[model samples]
Target: MEDFYPSRISEKPQIMKRRDPVIHTDRKHDHEAPLTKDQLDFYEENGFLQIENLFSDKEVAAMQKAIFELQESNSCVQSEKMIREPNSNEIRSIFAVDQDDDYFKDIAADQRLLDIVNHLLGSDVYVHQSRINYKPGFSGKEFNWHSDFETWHTEDGMPRMRALSMSIALSDNYVHNGPLMLVPGSHKYYVSCIGATPEDNYKESLKTQKVGVPDNDSLKWLVDQGGGLSVATGKAGTITIFESNTMHASTSNMTPYPRNNLFMVYNSVENKLVEPFAGAGERPEYIAVRKTTEPLGKEKILK
Candidate 1:
């Protein structure tokens, strides 16, 4: 309901989009295939990988249509997981679509996605969370520099950093449209808060709908050691996979172009969650799933 601005951005200048080598051209695949040795090595060393044109134009269109329809429907409005922009009424995010509709559920269980997750996380992975982010033109705000595991560990009670997130571009992510940026090789170090503890930070996230950001010194050190920043940008079908502990951020979309992406977090079945933080039990099923070990089926494959 309120405009949530990160403390770090108060004094900082407008976040600039970096032009690094975060987009991959050679690793593209159409069907379900395991990651190549080079892809694995890159992911291991850098903590992130980007594959271009992994999904077909037709498949992206179908998912995009579903998203638009759902956004307009009354069901999505009542779901309470549909987050709005800080100031405007435009929809910013829709969480846990798998539980609401069959289209997203099939997409969630697609073998093409599962195969890649298996390669990175080994077999027996379950969906920890799934959502579609809408970075509407001129209004989408910046996501601050933060590790997803920090929130998952502190708020959702995730035991370890055995999870990873896959972001599928439903709309083209251009440099001007707030494409995700990551500091390569930053996953090796779990940067603890210089200010708030994990629990206290989780409370802030609940109020603001944004994660706790890394301090200025920590961000500078990470950029210096991790080989600088790289932005993920590509066509609608491109997919970006990153480790849960990777330090990542995105700037505000100032251009007229809107960027939309489907984000899914997959966790190893062995590393289930515990309710450590207060009010964790009351969290919705769509935001934090309770099911475990349900590997997605091979019903929907992108051609």
Candidate 2:
């Protein structure tokens, strides 16, 4: 198999210097708080954490309304990042929502989220990407098993797996609605995939309406090392944070209920992407962000 390369493969700087981790002590925001000992321990041991009811109903509803409006609008750029569902024309994912709208931008900078991310990363964080995934009832496609860091590192020029993903369910994530499934503690094994490259995977996803998955051998090895697969199911406000290297996937939504989730990826400021893989110019600002380390202020938080 040919070695996989990110979309844009110019002879630019391909690697970045990994930054040393440092504990952030200054908590300038009211919502900012350090993670408890148990919470930290659990994340370190399992590579993920599920925090129930992290957002209030009003907050969730407001975001849902915004997403619905975006979906209803016909003007959203139909880029590869804003992918459509396999069979139907409905959008399956909306990438870089933070850059596209103010409401999502604030959510991306929420102190409640940054505090935990800051603690885990032991340094300042920047939004690498923000997206809203729409798993429409009965029509939602499957997301094949894969590790996020693999793509970020190989395609986006992210130096290491110091980033993490936070997913907030906009609708109740039930087992029947194709909730995300993760392999516990799989972050320990950074499986170098051999099959489709990131660019090919994106093309195939557009064609098949499914995420590009890992090879069968890698999948089996990850499951064996991580113990098994676990589903993430919870109320609308529940939040889940997973390490960048964790292997995760979701099944097709066969039920009539929809599962919508907001996903944000925060990368350590010190580990910014070198160059986008997509092409000559920068990848769309909404897909892979230009690195900025300025911390989010309290004023950015939504009430």
Candidate 3:
């Protein structure tokens, strides 16, 4: 495969102008999408959009309940899907969460969210990845700044920058509780990192990523270009949507409050997986999601 955004083989980082389109569709007035022209325009300029209350309080409560049940069930504790904090047993993330949980599956298929994704991708989309991230007070760790597409493209064989992540806050995300921080226009530039991916890196990288991280210079450049960092902090039920290549990260939860969010990646059906650009090979299905590419809500769910 031709590698437009190559990494993991170079000894230095390179910044390449983004070659792919950020907005795949021209029809901005999507009835079910609920995004106005101004909102779409902002996303086009910034590569991310933060909606204050996309989900209702009742809906947020139900989502929180579902997550509580999942945690109690210990379904992912023994599997690779569950990523624990470096210092504690508390889970940092649960990968491929909807594969076994019907509640999350329904959330993934929910028309209210899918419409916006469909409009953005300009095509029917499928669940490329899904997870719930937990940041417990005091023990939680920092997720260093990096672009998710950097890892997904190199290790997971995601072809183009045609994917986007939709993260819905499940609890109050305060400025001090390690709220998500993103560089507004950073998605337009792809930072190719320097490092060879270790074999079976997923086992370790899930907790603290080392291979696909951007260098400090590149991060600073993005920040400088964007003027400063923009944070996503709001009450439960808020939604933050961003392009796959957008630079984002969160700090450790040092305060008493906790931050939890449900993250789902929607990939255009046209931009499917290929051979891995780096690493041992294709990552496990839990992380990259190759088996089930069926469009959510429209086609039959692949088992």
Q: What is the C-alpha RMSD of each candidate to the true structure, in Å?
A: 8.2, 6.2, 2.8
| Number of the predicted model whose TM-score against the real structure is largest | 3
Per residue, candidate 3 scores C-alpha lDDT tens digits across 5-122 of 8988888799999989888875434443568888888898889998886777888999998886787677445977888788767777888887878889999989878878888887
Model 2 spans with C-alpha error above 4 angstroms: 1-33, 75-81, 195-201, 205-212, 275-283, 291-293, 298-303
Tell me the whole-model lDDT of each prediction, alpha carbons only: 0.71, 0.71, 0.86
lDDT of 1 at 296: 63
For candidate 2, list the clashing residue pairs, or say none: 7-277, 8-277, 8-278
Residue 152 local lDDT, model 1: 72
At residue 275, candidate 2 shows an lDDT of: 56
Give each model a TM-score: 0.81, 0.81, 0.95
Residue 38 of model 2: what lDDT? Answer: 65
Per-residue CA lDDT of model 2 for 1-303, tens digit only, reads: 122333224333132212322222333331444676666667766789899767778898898898888877734665666777767778888888877778899898888888788767656788888889888898988877877776676656676667899999999998788999999877766555443344444456434523224557667776887788889999987899998877888888999999998999988776778754332334445667774545554533232
Ten contiguous residues minimizing lDDT sum, candidate 3: 25-34
lDDT of 3 at 159: 84
